[model samples]
Target chain A: MTEKAIEISNLKKTYSGGVEALKGISFDVEKGDFIALLGPNGAGKSTTIGIICSLVNKTSGEVRVFGHSIDKELEAAKRCIGLVPQEFNFSQFETCKQIVVTQAGYYGVPRVIANERAEIWLKKLSLWDKRDTPARMLSGGMKRRLMIARALMHEPKMLILDEPTAGVDIEIRRSMWEFLTELNEAGTTVVLTTHYLEEAEQLCRNITIINHGEIVENTSMKDLISRLDMETFVLDVDRVPDSLPDMKEVSFRKRDEATIEIDVPKEFALNQVFHKLSDKNINVLSMRNKSNRLEELFVRLTEKA
Target chain B: MFSKESLIALQSIFIKEVTRYFRIWVQTLLPPAITMSLYFVIFGQLIGSRVGQMGGVSYMEYITPGIIMMSVITNSYSNVVSSFFSAKFQRSIEEMLVSPVPTLYILLGYIFGGVSRGLLTGIIVTLVASQFVDLEVHHWGILFFVVILTSMLFATGGLVNAIFAKKFDDISIVPTFILTPLTYLGGVFYSIQLLPEFWQTVSLANPILYMVNAFRYGFLGFSDIDIVHALILLSVFILSLFSLAYYLLTKGIGIRS
Candidate 1:
């Protein structure tokens, strides 16, 4: 019975050209919940964020944040919601510190407090040394970090990040995810949209998958993963095998001369496969799960849709 | 908390925009100064010597105020049009739109930014004009009032343009076709008194004519038309345009798509 930070009841949006972006979507995000919105391109992910942020006018339905309706008490709702848009949307002429501080000001935070918060976020993002550089002069990764810092300036109760780490290097992406996870743990409700399923699997506890502007699935990550009956295991061998076990329940693919990818259902026993390998005198080099629970669930759900 | 907080947000946007234009003084401030100086040399000195006095004052003095007002109008209009349109193009406006900032505040922030540039350019052009003519300020209050109102009017117009503009070409169309013709015909080079009777009445319909005459009245305490009527007309234009701009902003016209 935790308090809901964001509640959308049958929210819908339709453009003037008769293109429906959201078709009666309803969901609730409880306080401190880390939810990931997974969807293919043009799956109404951006449209949903746009409506909640009040950047797009809703054709019908309602969105409320912290009990304030976005259409009625928009300022109050917006004050509590921080949106990190997918694209870089900052003035190139302004410095990183200026960008974050200005956004804080827009939310009515005092200049001193804004500057202090900007400093803290910049340091946390490892961008403190580049604070004075104009945003255009920063690398693509730095600009993305600056966008995150700017969104965090107001100390919002709920944060929505749209594709936060797309196009970033792997190391920076992992660090960003860590920072976001820490932020969520510190009591901010986070709703994220990302194309990277692995990142979503690692970070989110609640998951919602949208397809063609409709919420195809909305459930806990554990429940979603459990719904998928399939699992994959990668087995490493010392040498190439001339023939593989012809098991009907498992599918295998060669990964070079020393490895094979095996897909198995959850009901199947892995011990039988291992016994079969040992009987053939194929030494097992290593074995690892090819897909995490979330990945398996996502593949199953998206493919089914 | 609400009023004070909103005021602070408005002030922040205004300050940022002011800083943006001032940071590039060489490009924003200097060009108007140089352009006005050339107007003085060619129209006031070269053309005025042969033409003699206009409205019982030296041609240099008569043309000086109009030239200054012209710079103010163009600068104010261009500043808002180009800046806001560029923000739209870059999608940077999403930052403000997504924040808790009010729509009126966003509109005012951009309008004030343009007003600041227009007033600054007008002041610089006036100073440059002084080097060419012995200017006399008959009514400082009138000069200040007219310049401010004129700047606000054009700044609002610029915002309207920016709201409707979808691309770079949209920014140049009005300035080139409408603004240029209106300013040139609005008694910048010649007095409306010099025009034929039918043309005089036709020129009166141009809103820029009223602004130019009102500003001219401010400097010399004289005008071809009734100065009070001109002031009233300019006020009406400002109020109407402001209302229109505010409505467009609140409706999210051309901004929220």
Candidate 2:
């Protein structure tokens, strides 16, 4: 089997009236990897997804899924992938079971097998009890799950979810993360686009950030975080301090009597800060980033673009 | 003519199209039957009673086949137009477009769906019309062929209209402005032979007239035009309309990005 689940080269899309949505972007997703494609609105993330799914035509490019060219072998390429769009696209009047089974049929799954897969996916997604309910009757979170279940009916090797948890509650979002994690563990390659940076940091091993219709960054999550120039952390101390410890490589200040905040540069280790603070007789109970570190980095990179 | 994926995709779309109208039986199936019944009662019973014999048959009997053909055309055309346009409106068309299904199946599925509805409504109208008068079929095969071909022709027209439709109003424009006018002038209520020589020539230009006359001939055992020639023209028209629809869909006239 090819290690590449998806590969795109020089993908370009110039919509009618000369609106350039995707400006010759290219990337790849290795098999079994959980990846995040992050970007702000109008960054061409959905356009890229649309091109891969054959919903949008590319002016000039090559896209392949598991070594099958989308143009020459679209059915074969599409059969290998599933897309959960940002919006609900299934018929509202259809029952949850009907939606999934119909989706399975589109992939040419046998009716009997479609039925079995419908049951299995619905059960796995905790939607079995609502199988007979019309899709419109499902809550926001349940509808998202229904889309996921429908997408998985064919058991494609790769699944792409665009903002899967946008309107979902935190609890349902966490459960979806767990579900996606389990799917990844089962050897499915997952490419997710989400506004929740915490989601990307928690669930994805690799990240690709697009900005202004181009690939701004494509690296492992760890490597991207390591490249951050600085991170601010807050220290919770055991006792109040009249003055904070002086540190040349770090900027420190007492946010409150018993708490202090510090800006730690990439080259300056937390241990060095701790070492210097301990020398000053300040005992730190717990320390954490003042804000979401990844969020800070994402904001900076996107704004810079 | 299709691969396995294409077949499955066609079946899925066909089933969905079938389910949509059936689910709303009162709205989709009931209106045509009721409308045609009123037509049968008024034109076939009350007004048709005083109108006397038309073409050697009673007025009501003369128009029965024409009315049934009209119902089939209106229903089949409306079913695909409304259904396909609704899919576009709700963005559910993306479900199939984004899938591995071939685009031709999407077209066929909706086409068959409209044909089914049109044919079903034709049956209902035929049964309803039979209540007022005994409909003796001079040729059953011709009746079936003409009705099916007419339904398919208009269904293809509806698909074409839908691909160009941007709003709800766009969907209604063709059926109201173009289709209804054509059907009314197609000799549904009266024979075009009764018209003056010049007006008769104008009526001959209407494509619907051949369909109505051909269908009426199937039931009355005679027609104003040659049955064989009319069948060929109808077939050609159906093929041309289908080709245009297929072309528009492939070009992504309205549904693609």
Candidate 3:
């Protein structure tokens, strides 16, 4: 049997102003699984992570981290989890190396060992060169990566990152994704909350979507993506066409002389569209998804919730 | 919470707190040393020449211990209050809160930072006053006791202040309006014997007065309040403030939200 990395049952959180941030949501993550928690703004994603880290008190329910009860064995539970918050919470005056070393110290790593691990993590995250510089001096991307390095320093069993890639540029975001993928591959159970749906699709094997303070979907990524009923693709053609050709089981429209868009339902094979286009003697240069499948599903699910 | 790992966690926090204050020495360490030197110059030499004797001792000598106690109280209280409040404002305090470090350790770490500052300032001020007023050591044991206890007491109060404070103004309101007044009227420059009987009774209510008088008693072997009651009151305030600060910390009053 697979062990559960985190087991949250009937979790609820209601702020003092009577705002119900979470309403009895429950889910379980198998050990070593990479997961994404998707939600719209004010949909209680942060409140849920806050409760998991014990930053926000739960109104009701139970949370256990790696089988350690947060309420009863708080120290043990906290020891197994490291949190990378959505905002930059580290001190501006401290150097990058000091931040990570101090974090390791909080988890009871000896100073010598903590320093060694800090060096390793900072080097791995491409921050070793800037280790002596103050945190305030680092660029936005470096700061984001600094937070990740600090989280990884203690080697927690589960690393929870809340919008870790927010505001990062595309190139750096992809690099961070690679690093996190590598970290997850090293057997750390990773749970990420992100606004980027494509990142979720690329990195996560398990998917949990929360909307309106409730879990709308929790299943394997394969199952969730399979539930997507239709996908739209844009095909770039080599030659200009006077008019577009009609096709079966697909909706086609010319976006421009060189580009055409098509909606292909799950019932039709994409190869059939290519076969028909070839039969019409249209030279296709490239084809790409008009919209990311998970994105469309995310919008549809969150809009309904 | 009392395990070996907790001790290491405490040591880490303590080191950070110490490093922070020392790192900003101009802001943290130098100001108190400069302020106390100015006090010795203006109050001891310039004013004591005219004020004559107080509490059966020269005005300069009589005010020496009181001045030192004042520095300890003010510096200790301000140190913890400002440092902790800054951590809250920057949201860096969440580092310790989310860790396995116990709440008691968090409070102790900040208090020690305050205590260290208080004692250092007191020592520097005492040395500065020594050059102006003839130094005397009537009871070294009581001198050490009063100085240490007074620092601990105010450091705990500062922790409570920091825990409840929501904004920068919240942190200053207590020290400015309440702490300054209490310290001034606590007889740092004059003896309460000059006051009317009823005002003397009210002066007794200020906790700083007890600390100052006990410290005064240690220096000149003379004090308006009973030394025994002063010790008892100091212990009580320490216990109460420590308990309240610990409770506020565990409750996550202003820091959590």
Candidate 4:
């Protein structure tokens, strides 16, 4: 089996005012695994990433990357990991090419090699067209892409992206997701944190949801979605009934004289509800699922927690 | 966890910072030169015509080294303070904090950057001051030693200020309320010999006074206090400030959060 790309165990972090940011959290990422960390606001996602990247000092725990302890062999471990933060943090005066090349130099890449790698990554991210422009002059989406190019210049085996698509438009967000998917497919271990549950659902095979500084769920996406059996279907009918069917496994709401919304568990087949409506002589006009499997799973899990 | 690669990272950051300040030489290097020239014209030329000699040297020549040292101190301290604090404010310092580069390298990188600008501005001011007065250096070795050491000491001081500074205003508070006052009282314009006996004793406690006098002694071959003691005191201050700055950086104080 391939080695574990990252192993974090019993991590705990307490700020100065006794605020517990991470309370004994633990997880592992296998080589080439694409995992999404889903969480709400103030859920310690940033803290976890910060500790792994050695930006924030952990109160207690062990983090290992590529079988090397971060505390003991920080440089060796860090050399293999690249982090793209949520905010724009590059020097305002530096051009996109300069930012990437300088970051490569920090990892000991020779200047010529760094330049080559920077060019390749910038081109891959579609940022080569603006290579000479100062980073501060770039649009928000371009700056985000520039950050990703900079992070990739070192050719790290593992990449951690915190909200890589936040604040981006739909078209740009989709392109970024596609680009990251390609990167992961090319054998890089990817760890992502994002507020968009749909993005996580579409990209990640495995997921860990953090809330209140603790991991509420860590499992395969299939398993998590399967566990949330609730699904909703909105139906348009020819007419409204004076009273709805009293099915224990399903709930229905009348949208208007001709539309109704029904929520039912997966085990209770939709065919049964349709059969009941047919028996009542009500014609079903149209139907659609109100939420995707992943949305249902996320809402159920977070609400219960 | 020092490595060849980490040193390369330090050098990259140092070079970037040096390029940043020098790229805007009109703002970073010109202002000091102009300010020092005003001092030479006002104090050395206008005021010195009536004050005559100080410490057995012409008044213009007596204050030349002190003014140059003052410029070096201010520039060195401000360079790091402003640059580092701006990095903190912009949240770009996280780039270095997250990298494998050690904290010592980051500190040294900033210190070297500050020292470069400080020394460069000092040289320019010195050249400018020479046009106003016939300056003579009695000991080039002492002069060079004092200039470099004093620049380093203040550069380290700037790092400390940057680490503790929480806001943009915090950066100015020290240079204005503390550094400027200590510098003026440190005998940049007049020899400590002219102060009252009690004030002279109190002036001995100010570290900048030693730096100014040591630098002045290098040029004039005379000092109100022992130059050897001044050198030792300045060395101790540099070591202490360096240690404090390094400790704060490694602990991830202010920069990490």
Candidate 5:
């Protein structure tokens, strides 16, 4: 049987102000699985993460991290998990290295070991040069990376990040994705909450969509993507044909002289569309999805809830 | 007994708290030294020349222990309140809350940090007063016990204040409106013997009076209050405040949702 990284059963949380943030949601994240917990704003994603990390108290629930019950074996449960909160929570005056080393110390890692690990993680995250600089001096991207390095200092078995790339640029976001992929590949159960649906599709093997304090969709990413009834693709062509081609299974429209968009249902194949375009003497230069598949599915699932 | 991991976790928070205060020495460490020095200059020397004797000693010598205790109380209380409140304000306190560190360890770490600052300030005030009067410790053992207990009690009280404080203003309100008045009336400059009988009876209700009188007894070998009762009262207050702070933390009051 596969080990479970996390098991949340019938979790519920109602804030002091009578806001029901979570209403009896249950889920399990398998060990070593790369997963995404995607949700729209105010959809209980953060509350769930906060409860898992012991930051937010739950109304009633049982949470186990690697078989250690959070309510009973709290210390043991916390020891197995590392959390990167949605916001920057370290002291602004502390140096990047100090922030990471101090985090390791909270987990009982010796100073010597913490220093060595801080050096390695900082270097790996491209923050070695900024290690000695105060956290306030770093740019937005560097601060995010510093939080990641700090989370990894104790070498936790599972890592959970809440919107870790919410404000990062494309280049840095892609680099972060690569690093997370590598970390997941090395047997760290990685669970992340992100607004970027494309990031979820690209990195997660399984996805959970939440809305209105409930889980709307929970399944393998492939299964979820397969459920999409239709997809739109933008095809770059050598030139626009004088007249548009007609097809029964696919709808084609001219976006520009060099680009054409096609809505292809699951029953239709791209090869058939290419055959029709070739017959029209329109050569294809490149092709890409018009919209992220998970994004469309995410919107549909969350909107219905 | 604490486990090894808990000890390391305690050490981590303790070091972090110390580092935070030291990092802003101008704001945290310097003010008390400067403030206490001024008190020695104004109240001990200039004013003592005219005020004459108190508690069987020159006014300067009488106020020396009181001044030192005052510095210790204020510095210790302010240190923990400001540091803990700032951590909460910045949300950095979540770092410890999410870790495996026990709540007791967190409490002790910040209290120890406050005690360190308090004792350091006490020493600084004492050294500064030495230039104003012939400083002496009549009973070194009682002096040490009283000073240490006083710091611990105030530090614990500071933690309680920090836990309940929601904003920057909330942290200062207690010190300004309550703590300062209590310290001033706690027999820092004049003994309770000088007060009218009724006012003296009322002053005994003040917790700070017990601490100050006990601390004074350590230096001058005499007190307006019973030394044993004062020690017992100090211990009781410390225990009560420690329990309250621990309960607040465990309940996640004003911190967790």
Candidate 6:
């Protein structure tokens, strides 16, 4: 039987100042599965990640990684996990190569093997040419990539990244997506927490949304998107209409001279809407989903919580 | 229990710490040497010419061991304080926190690094002192024992200070207000024998006096304090300080949330 990569049971954390960060939330990530952990600001995402990585002391919980309990077999659990924190936590004085190799050494990899892995990972992340430069000298995107290379140095079975591409440009972000997809395909369990809902829809197979220290939604990506009660579509028309079409279970708003937004319930049919528009003598130029489906569900879930 | 993996982690942490000091040699190494040289020139020559001999030797020779001990004490304490506190401030210490390295190995790694800097600075000060006076070790075993143990004690002290430090300024407060005052009054310039009966009794309460006199006995073959008692006191202090450092680290005091 395959083992779960991470299993958090009733995990909770209260800061020294009496702020309750995680209020008994629990979840699991299957081995080799790519999952997105989505939440809004101050939603306890980072606190949960920090407890899993042993960076923050959990007030009470049972967290297991690959069959090892974090409290009883902490060393074993830690050895299997690699963490890319939300902030840059490496020394600014050290070169890129030094930072990655040093991380391998922390995991007990020999210096020779660490050097080899550092080179390969840096090269894979497109940072080999800049390996000798100090970390402070690297651009924001390069710094993020350097963090990824460092996280992969020990060849961990699971990689957890917290906002790894927070400030990266679109080109670099897409490249990172491709890299993460390739890594996950190679049997590495990846748990990502990101603000970009579209990226989560494109990359993760499953989703878990948290708010106010509670788990509000957890399911497969396909199922979660399908649960949306209504979807808004933007239609570009050939010309502005003089009057609106009277339709049941559908609502329309005039966005502009050439654009109209229509909200279609899950029970409604798109063909009937097109026929009604045809009857109205309004030619639809093109149509597209108004916003990311996952985003819509995320907003509703967090707001409801 | 010591495993191969933990050994590697210890070596890595030690190497990283050493590299930090070496990388900033001008700031870490050079200053101690220059500071001790000034003490030698001003106190050992300009002032010693008038003070005559001390403890059955020339004034310059009497202050040499004390000067070396002072450098070791300050450098060992400063190395661990600055390095560990900087790691905390930059949040780089989380690297070790997230890794599988045991807290024992991490503490040992940093303590060894501080010891290395302390000994190196001691040797540099000794070399600078030799230019002014012919230096000889009266007892090589005692010399090595005292210096090493003294460095260990102060390094552990530095670790405790670092663990309690919340800011860069916090690291300096101990060194300036506490460590410096104790070192200066700890019989570096004058033997406690020169003090009045009451002050002499009071000097015995200071811990740095034992380290300085123990180290001084290694050089001149005599000390105002008993060498055996000095060694015993140094060992106890090291054991106690190490326990405190280990406890603080395991509790995640300053470096962890």
Error of 2 at B45 (Å): 0.9
Query: Which ten residues in a row are the worst by lDDT in model 2 chain B?
Result: B1-10
Expressed as tens digits, the lDDT of each residue in A214-303 for candidate 5 is 999889999998899998999999999878789988889999999999989977768889999999999999999776777788878988
* Location of the lowest summed lDDT over 10 successive residues in candidate 1 chain B: B1-10
- Candidate 1 clashes: the total is 0
For every prediction, compared with the true complex, DockQ reads 0.80, 0.70, 0.76, 0.61, 0.83, 0.83
Candidate 5 lDDT, tens digit per residue, B176-246?
99999999999998998889999999999988988888888888888889989999999999999999999
Candidate 4 per-residue lDDT over residues A215-277, each given as its tens digit: 999998888877876788889899989887768788978989999888898788788898878
Name the candidate, 2 or 3, with the larger TM-score value: 3
- Mark the 10 consecutive residues where model 2 chain A has the least summed lDDT: A239-248
lDDT of model 1 at residue B9? 86
Docking class of 6: high
| Worst 10 contiguous positions by lDDT, candidate 6 chain A | A239-248
lDDT of 1 by residue, B1-257 (tens): 34877777888888888888887888889999888888899988998899998889999999888899899999999999988887888888888898888888888888889999999999899889889988888888888998999999999999999999998999999999999999999987778989999999999999898888888888988877887888899999989999999999889898896
Query: Tens-digit lDDT track for model 3 on B1-257?
Result: 68877777888887887888788889877887788778888888798879988877888898899889988998899889988988888888888888898998888888888889899888888888877878888888888998999999998999888888888899889989999999999988888889999999999899889899989988899888988899999999999999998888888888774
lDDT of 2 by residue, A17-69 (tens): 79998889999999889999999999999999998988888899899999999
Reference-based lDDT, residue B61, model 5 = 83
Model 3 stretches with alpha carbons more than 4 Å out: A239-243, A269-282
The DockQ assigned to candidate 5 is 0.83
- Candidate 2, residue B70: Cα displacement in angstroms equals 1.1
Tell me the tens digit of each residue's lDDT in model 2 across B1-257.
47776787788888888988999989989988899999999998999999999999999999999999999999999999999888888888888887777667878888899999999999999999889999999999999999889988988888998889999999999999999999999999999888999989998889999999999998998888788989999999999999999998887779888
Error of 4 at A165 (Å): 1.0
Worst 10 residues of 4 chain B by lDDT: B1-10
- Sorted into a CAPRI-style docking class, model 1 comes out as high
Error (Å) of candidate 5 at residue A14 is: 1.0
Model 5, residue B118: distance off in Å is: 0.5
- Output the worst ten-in-a-row residue range by lDDT, candidate 3 chain A: A239-248
